[model samples]
Target: MIAQRKDDHVQLAVEQQQQHSGRNQFDDVSFVHHALAGIDRPDVRLATSFAGLSWQAPLYINAMTGGSEKTGIINRDLGIAARETGVPIASGSMSAYFKDPDCADTFSVLRKENPDGFVLANVNATASVDRARRAVDLIRADALQIHVNTVQETVMPEGDRSFSSWVPQIEKIAAGVDVPVIVKEVGFGLSRETVRLLESLGVRAADLGGRGGTDFARIENGRRPLGDYAFLHGWGQSTAACLLDAQDAPIPVLASGGVRHPLDVARALALGASGVGVSGTFLRTLLDDGVAALIARISTWLDQLAALLTLLGARTPADLSRCDLLINGELRDFCADRGIDPRPFARRSGGLDVPHEMTGSTR
Candidate 1:
């Protein structure tokens, strides 16, 4: 049953990607072009540090699939891409392995294929400390991502209804696990309050798995008899909005969900994301094309990211924070209502003077 469910998830995710349309909040963000930007492409760097480890690139292949033969093949191909591209890869929720130990090899394939590369083991927030450790040992993971998906659970036909233990359980897992713990959202974005809660728990990082990517609510609803919960399809903040919410967070903020191309990756970095994760888009490429094509695409993204940084007058991923940005459309409204000052983002370089009302003060 678990294996079949995993397979369903993979198939549904692919179908969703193929038919997905409309612009995400990333569209509301625009970079202030620097015509006199003197930085050269060769001098621009993509290397970044997040989740207590150094990454060759600012982006990684986020958690996707495992636990079934079909999903295992997908994992193998993704692992190969990561190995060739020198980017991190994460396994889908290992809850299936805990349910059926026989499925261990499915998740283990990630380590088998990319022995020396950075691998992240994923588990739900409800996992006990012992289960969390086993997940890490299963993949020899350098880091662990404990995903919180209240919305997904609510919409999933067979999902858990209890949520009282999530925070306490996550705190225990974060403290007991040897590897760095990154609290992640599945598809819903993390809010500033939630980010603060993770920081208070002493977690090393947070992955703002914001909306605008694969819609798990829609997927879970598709499994239902009536296909209800369509109204909840647009639930939660976007990756770009979550990045704005996470400004100056004590822990490193990683962005994912709704990231389409290399420019979106650059936009996330400029919005203060230490790292970015691409799952649905990358998975679509691999399934539609082949592993070789995915590898070439990732390589192309790296090159494009360098050129973007040079064009923005930033020398490195961290330096992107200093580049100016202009927030408009619904995203600007979100900032105003959320008490976030969007002007700071637009005046990052301190080249333009903000108006009295546009000063750094939040509502």
Candidate 2:
């Protein structure tokens, strides 16, 4: 059953059904460009730290497929790419492997291929401390990603039914694990309330796995008869809006979801993200162009990211928040309605107009 599920995930992944109606919320956000950035592209730095581990760039490979031969090949190639590029990589959920020990090699190969590189292990938030430990040990992980997918799971026909005890279980694992625990959302954006809850539980980092990326609702629903859950296809907030909520978060926020362009990564940093994660897009690149093309694409993205930072007068990821940004369109209203105060986004340049609330439809 586990093996078949893994193959289904891989097969669904191969299809390009990850599209959404979201403007990615990025369409409403714009950064103030400084004509005299002063620093050269070579001077820009993206190196960052998360949970005491250093990353060559402020980017990571978000969780994806595993537990089958096709996925195993993808993981091996992704591992080799991470090894060569010096970027951190994470495996898909390891629950399948734990259920069937024969599938362990699928995820284990990531660590074997990248002996010294940073590899992250993933599991559900309700997983036990022992299971979390086993997952970490199985991959020699530097950090662990506990994905929160209540909505996704509820939508999956064969998904876990009990979710009432997830918080206590998460609290236990967060305290028990030696490695850093990154509480991640699966495509649905994390609100400040959620971040506050995790902070109270002692979690130090969060991946606001916002929407406008892969629609897990669409994916899981596609597996059902007639893809019936189509009405909920556009559920949740965009990644950009989620990052806005994280602006004042006590802990560092790692932004993910629909992070298609390198420029969007810059915008994520501008909203105070400590790092960024890209999954579906990276997977698509690998599946379409092979490992060599995937590596080249990563190189191009890193380069373009540096150039974008230079244009924004940010010499490093740390400098990104200093630049004033403009929040236009419905996103501005989202910030206003949520009490986030979009004024500050424009205040980086001193002052600007704060749009009035729209009475009716907002894109």
CA RMSD, predictions in order? 5.9, 7.6
Lowest lDDT 10-residue stretch of candidate 2: 351-360
Tens digits of lDDT, candidate 1, 198-231 = 9988789999999999999998888889998888
Stretches of candidate 1 exceeding 4 Å from the true structure: 352-363
Instruction: Give the Cα error of residue 264 in candidate 1, in Å.
Output: 0.5
| Candidate 2 lDDT, 1-363, residue by residue in tens | 777777777667557434444356878889866555445687788898756668889887889879888789989999988887888898899998878889899999999999999999999977889999999999999999999987788779898789889888888998999999889998988998899899888777999999888878777888888788788776888889998877778888999998888988888888888899998888888988899988888888888888887777677887888788889888898888888888777667443222345334474
Full-model lDDT for every candidate:
0.91, 0.84
Compare the candidates by TM-score and give the number of the best one: 1
TM-score (C-alpha) between model 2 and the true structure: 0.93
Cα misplacement distance, residue 130 of candidate 2 (Å) = 0.7
What TM-score, computed on C-alpha atoms, does each candidate reach? 0.95, 0.93
RMSD of 1: 5.9
